[model samples]
Target: MFCHSMTNSMGEIMKKDKLVFKSVLLTSASFAGYNIGSGFATGVEALQFFAAWGGKFAFSGIFLALLTSMAVLIAIYVIGFEQRFVKSSDVYHYFCGKYFGIVLDYYIYVSMIFVTFTMMSGAGATISQHSGLPAFAGASIMGILCFVTAHLGLERLRKALSYLCICTVLFVLFCGGYAFLTSGVSPIAGSANSEHYVSMGLMLRANTFGIQNPYLSGLSSAGLLIVSGFAWASATGSLCNSKREAVFSGIFSSLFFYMTTAVVVYLVLTSMDHVAGTEVPMLAVVHFLLPKLSVIYSIIIILAIYSTISGRLFLIAKRYDRGNKAMGFVIILSITILAIVGASLISFSKISNVVFSIMGAVGIIVCIIVLTRFIIAETMPKQLL
Candidate 1:
């Protein structure tokens, strides 16, 4: 009874001291920045895992969004609450052991480093894919730009880049809404097949390779969404530095994301009569809906890729030695080299699945560890694990 009363009192205090609206908005924007990347804006990812290869598995995306929002909300709330006790540096330590925490921290550092390189490569690829620049050349220039901008630190980078991603997403949503209003909606031709595939449990783990078993697929999907949320929440917490701020930001940003993606799904699904594959569905939709706006979208794609690269670079800088001159040189040099190699070996169309697969597994374990700690802290005594 005492514990229950204490729990209730804590909840009331938390609710009363909830994240302010302004802080929440900032947090959500940061989270949005993390969530909207190459695979997100292009719809290639949606097509591969959720739409085409998944065989009209439309509901999977919805499920993904739902699960992602829930996990993120929890993560953000925990991070926000923990701000009094733990800074961003100790978030991992609180989740896992000191050894495990260090491992996870370094893993996060490595992941951010790689993610920075990949984003730079992706920027160049987007330019090559859209403009006439060679992918290699594009990668080099992008890597340079990212390294320069990342030096400015998180405050400046987030202020500048968040708008870029947010604007592009808003544009896409506005266009999608317009398209839907004008053309009207229609069901997928093989909706039954997609539904059946989902029902049969293939859609959850529908890979480029083949259908995974029901159990594995379900778990994989669950894992991906959860990690996405955790990663997003960590980024959010870093931005807001409070639990209430993270929660509110997560809630608003997630709503915006869902609405935006829902519009994309509608636009892409409706335009299938005119466009088939998922690879360039956005381009197709743009070409079909407003031919004159092609250049605008091309720019948007390039900027979206840029925002991601810059954000990742800043993340890497923060994780590594923020003040060390040698670390900056290393980050720049390493990322540039990796970008060149990445450009040579991988195309967004080719390597997204593999990257997500490896990252997804690691992300899930991290998220679970963090979430378990949060739950225990909230519910149990410190004496218990």
Candidate 2:
């Protein structure tokens, strides 16, 4: 009965059902893969939020991953709704529209395009930092690649693009491991910064490079991580269905996120001193720990960026196909312009913040509406029971 409800055939259900353990692992990795780009992969974000607070913050990151898992559950259930409601993947339209539906649809669509653009710009910046590639060139290459992928329908691209996430984990682990073996520890793991420790009785508090107050700092970081996860899961929820599936997938995905992020953060903190002040903390560590490996990892980082850009494009195209052309065209154009703006003014960390902020705003609204609708629908009886 469960299988039938999932899909018409076993094959179809298999495609939609929580992937097998291994595939789920890969999918989760892909989810995080695109989710974490230059700033994330390089520990710039971890530094600001996680590593800046020192070892104490790692636990916060783990907890945030758990929240991400919850968001994934919400997303999966939305996907199931997509299958049932519209018989299409155009999940945004169902929720956003009033009478015409185009108003909200345009908003969602534009938001998606902006997201993809920002992602591509970020990839370019990462490549510049890691590989010495021209940032514009790198961004252009990645953008074009994503454009091609978007031209294809999403159903064909989802599985293929997911591999990028898996590859990202393996590359980070391999590079970070090598750094750990050779570089040895520095200060970040439980080492108290004098500034953070000595900042008692000050008006605004003494300044520190990393965390000023460990406990409060950790909580703030955790909030950012969970907020980031929520934005991502809510935006992608249309692809998943079933509360059980959403919850399970979220748990699985968050586990990978926290584990991998912890290792990378640790590696960065131990090998590179003064990284907290740098624009690219992870790159500083890589450049210090193993220059040769940094080159290789740089390529992988570019690919990771591409993977996310591709996913965003595919989603936009899919959503556009289901809606009015006027709004759809506007969305695509606005996203293109937004990407260019981000490319000009933003770096990896800032772009990530924008992406997460947009996702957070859109996601919370969508989640409330969808969950409420689902509950109401399920409770209604033959005569409004």
Candidate 3:
């Protein structure tokens, strides 16, 4: 009898552990998918923020920046779990006061729409570059797809994002790792061609919002991530079964996010000669390394773009839909139409460079507020929220 009872207890414990592990992975993948938009998928964001600094600064700078971003993400998750927020935007109100939080909320709301536009542009750029299809065709396809997935609601969206995130990360790691290993040029070694070396000053000027200082750049990047991803992160946190799950998800997701970034940065640095002046640097590198995979890589980029836009559009539609199915459909359709039109007109690089910088600057302010709140919460004897 005693032996049988012990066996039952052990089995239960194992089952519980398995469930927690599964939950952590799903949460981590969903969070990663939410953040991996066009800029990240194409390596443009990494190139501008990290690799552009040359091999020496790229690793250290990206690590620091991603660390800061990771901390911010963890804090948001913890707070979200504790509060159990109904509306995701309320996270801004919690970090900032009611008035300022309201302002930031609206700002982020509009910014999310703009980010969707950027994703549309990225989709168009990826397709046009790869297959010579009209940019609008790609944009329209992405917009429609995102709308459909998002309309499926949160439960379905979460599962879809998780699976897509896994596939995308695996693809990136394989390509980046393969490129770095196969490329004869060492990443740390400065480029032999002085003409190809992009000076820090020139890179800073060309990037517009690019911060030459690694620390500041990291903060800005963290800020941008926190601001743009606040809704999804907070929502994901609320779904956690316990604080342990939230923390685990945050740590795993953060490490995975930065690890993939480091690989891409290394790949870009080694292949700077080939990727320079290209709109999609990662695609260019993949083409140079494995020409056969370029077309497949293009589809992967679109899938990544789809994952991100679905989350953004879901949040936007949910906020305005207010439980009305017809209203939600109309909202998604209108946004898709507007995004497709905007993407058709604007260049992907311009939107990524100029608009993202401005958003990152705004995001910095939000990050400060979140950090301050987190510090205070930790110091207090009682839970503030």
Candidate 4:
């Protein structure tokens, strides 16, 4: 009872303390920044994921995703609290078991290479469209930034990402508010719904676009959140002052994220038909709303992409280094070469779609393990094993 009381007190303290608010905001922003990468900022990601599903599915899918996510996120946060996993490898080891954990650690190293590819692709797309530069120029610039930021160490990286994420959100809010004010069409216009609840085919084919397994949208999306949020939770949860603070941060940050996403979705839905066809959906909408300032919007897209690239590269360097300066430099150099190659090969959307789908399955498995462990720990009276 006393423990429960303390938990309640921690929750209240989180509300009253300005420092706690900053910590929670920072932690949440870090996680959000990591998860909201190139595809997300461009808005093509939402066009494919949420807007594809129409009004009702988008509505229900997002709600279910958040509901299921809170439980899984809290479970993951609790494990991180107990284990204090300071390394990316330690995070995989804890959730994936001993043998599989080793495999996953290697898998993540390989997988991050592909994500690095997508970032390069995004940077190329942005500069090519906005400044008429060669695609390689943008990719090279992003690679250099990521290379530099990786060496800044995690503490500085977190501070940097928090500021970038705050800017991204503020910019998004401004764009969303502007779009909403000027939007003549309603959000559900051309949606798969007359009204979301009254829409037919609630299960399969629920999406406005013809993306497959519309029924799995909620689960797959929830899985994506877990997979993307996993690295941050395991790698950074210890930043919170206590388990209570960690949980508080996780819950509220998620709320902040989905709330922001809801705005983006509304904006996308209002301009659904047009944004759906573009390579950079957010830029497309901004161009439509405020064409005179498209140059500034492009810069924001590049910054958003750069933020994720830097954070991912930092984690990869730390993975190899365990904080050794020489080894971290070597890993960063090798990854930079591979990312340059990735830019020459494919477009951003193609790479992001493939990477997100592959990682979604892995995220689901991690969430299941955490949920099972939470259940078992609850059933046992004496201890958490």
Candidate 5:
């Protein structure tokens, strides 16, 4: 009897451990999936932000960006733990108070819509570039799929996104590693072949945000991610079984994001001369290094875009959902239509550059406020009693 009881206790302990591990992975993958949208999967975002700097600056910039962004992510996850049962919009209210939170909440709504439009445009661009299909067809297909997935609500969205995120990260890692190993050329070496190389100075000058400093660029990058990922992070946090799981998920997710980003930046740097002018730098790298896998990579890009689109759309629907099933459907359908139409008019590159930069500026302010609040909360005396 004593032996049987001990064995049962061990089994229960093992099961709990497995459960915690699974939660951490799901939360981590969902966070990664939300951030790895069109810009990230395509390598365009890294090209503009990190690879553009080149040399040590590129790596250092990415490191700084990850550091700051990870700090913010951890805080967001903790808030999720505290307010797990609250509505998604309540996160903003908690961080900024009722009035300012209200403003931030509405701003996030607009930002999420714009990001959805950008992802729609990205999907169209990827398909058109690879298969010569009409951009509208690609955008329409993605928009419809997003509507369906998001309508299923958070439980389904998280599982689908977690799987998609794992696939994307693995593919990117494989392709990047394969390309780098076979190229036999250092990333810095590509910079020497300056046929179409745009210097960092020129690139920064062309940026809409007027951010000349690489460090500032890092901050802006972190800001962009923090703001765009706020809703999903809060939702993921609420799903955590414990504070340990939430914190672990945040750290692991941030590290995974940084690692994949750095790999893409490395790959782009290795072929900067060729990918510099291309619409999709990662696709360009794949075509150069592994032409046979271009189709596969394109599919992955669409999936990555799909993951982000669904997450953003879910947040939008959840904002007004309030247990009204039909209303949620209407909101998602209307937004999808608007996104598809808007994406049709603008080029993907133009939308990515202008819209993301503007949002990044807003994101920076949001990060500062959140960080400040976190600092004060930690530093203040526990009690005046």
Candidate 6:
């Protein structure tokens, strides 16, 4: 009887641990979802940053960009824990000082709204591609959903995105991986062949210096990474009970994001020809792999849209008059309307060129501030650390 009691007690402890483990994964998955939204999920990010370079060179450029971005994410997440920050502005103030911090605080609204807009546009593009729906119809549907979801409050926000993130990550990995391995199309196959076979370092430099605005793509890639991950990851970090948990969650989140990107990149390269010029590239790849599941594929992308909008709205809400639900609703509605207008005005690829590239510039500014703080902290006395 005592042995039976002992076994039951052990089972309870294991069950508790399993709950914690699942909790961590769900939170991390939410962070990963932020990165895998319309931009990464739809293939616009890959097309502009990596696919434009043609074949494997695009992958190389993305590697260089992601390498720097990864460092920025890790630093920001760890510092977020150390500072015990509750908002993105707090971290900005720590690294950027007072005036700049306030400047960034305002910019956060603009930058995030812009990102939110792009997500709306991406959802539109994906749905239109999936069926014959108009882009306006698709964006409006997404905008309505996001606006409503914003009203459900934070705990529900967390739960909704957590489940959505799980679905997104699974589809991207399994579907994307399978598509890449079996797809017959490859953009690299038909490249000029002049620079097709270049070395990784040279390939990156060739693309970096090879383009009209050489710094645009690389800088934007890093910049978007900053916008997407830091605030969400930091919030996730601050929720943990201990420093170790915070750091582990942040790293795990980043790992999953990179893994999704790698799979999308591979799938894009394999079907680079079909997707390169298209608005919703990943959807194109999906259609090729599972033609009948187009609607299902689109639904998954829409689910991802919810996660992105929710995370962005969460950050935006904290900046307003202390969780003012009304103000948050106004802000979300206003942005969603604007996003619908902008999304309807152009092709997904054109928006990528204009909007995201600019965001990339913002990212560079953010990276400088974070790195400066990191440098000073490391050089300072032990007390600061």
Q: Whole-model lDDT for model 1 versus the true structure?
A: 0.60
Q: Which ten residues in a row have the lowest lDDT in candidate 2?
A: 201-210
lDDT per residue (tens digit) for residues 248-336 in model 5:
87788788888899999888888877776667788988888889999999999999999899989888888988878899889999999
Using all chains and alpha carbons, the TM-scores for the candidates as numbered come to 0.79, 0.69, 0.93, 0.86, 0.92, 0.83
- Candidate 5 has what TM-score? 0.92
Quality of model 2 by C-alpha lDDT: 0.55
Candidate 6, residue 232: CA error in Å?
Answer: 1.7
What ordering of candidates by TM-score runs from best to worst?
3, 5, 4, 6, 1, 2
Writing each residue's lDDT as its tens digit, candidate 4 over 1-385 gives 9999999999887776877778878888877777666766777556555766676566666676677777777777766776787566777776667898888788766666777788788888778867778778888988887787777777787888888888888888998888777776767674534234223312122221224554455556667677666666666677777777678766865776676777776776676555554557677777777888788888878888888888888777877786678888898889987897788578766666777666655656666877886677657885545
lDDT of 1 by residue, 151-229 (tens): 7665676566567767877889788777867875553652335445445533322342244432333334335434443
Local distance difference test scores for all models:
0.60, 0.55, 0.80, 0.71, 0.83, 0.69
lDDT of 2 by residue, 1-385 (tens): 9877656676776665545454445445556764665546656555654565455454564465346444534444444434454423344344434543455456555655655656666666767776577767667776666655555544444465567777778877887678667665654542245235323311111112223444433334333333333334444444553455455556666666667777776775565344544455666677777777777776776776666666665556555556565665555555655675567566655665455444444444444555555565557883772
Q: Which residue pairs show backbone clashes in model 1?
A: 80-242, 80-243, 81-243
**Candidate 5 residue spans exceeding 4 A from truth:** 1-14, 193-196, 199-209, 379-385
Model 4 TM: 0.86
Query: lDDT (0-100) at residue 46 of candidate 5?
Result: 85
Cα lDDT, model 6, residue 106: 80
lDDT of 6 by residue, 1-385 (tens): 9999999999998997787677667667767776677887777776666655666465565666656676676677677667777655787777778998888768767788877878888988887877778999998888888777766654566667777777877887887657656654554663334144223212221122234333456556777778666677666656565555555665666667666676776776666445544678778878777778767878888888867876786667666746676777777677778888888877766666566766676777788778778778868997865
What's the C-alpha lDDT at position 365 in model 2? Answer: 48
Error of 4 at 176 (Å): 1.4
Candidates 1 and 5 compared by lDDT, better number? 5
User: Residue 161 CA error for candidate 5 (Å)?
Assistant: 0.4
Candidate 1, residue 182: Cα displacement in angstroms equals: 2.8
Q: Write the residue-wise lDDT of candidate 3 on 184-263 in tens digits.
A: 68876633331354542223211324544655665666666777788888888999899888878777777767777787
Task: Score residue 249 of candidate 2 by CA lDDT.
Answer: 53
lDDT of 4 at 280: 71
Q: Which candidate do you rate higher for TM-score, 2 or 6? A: 6
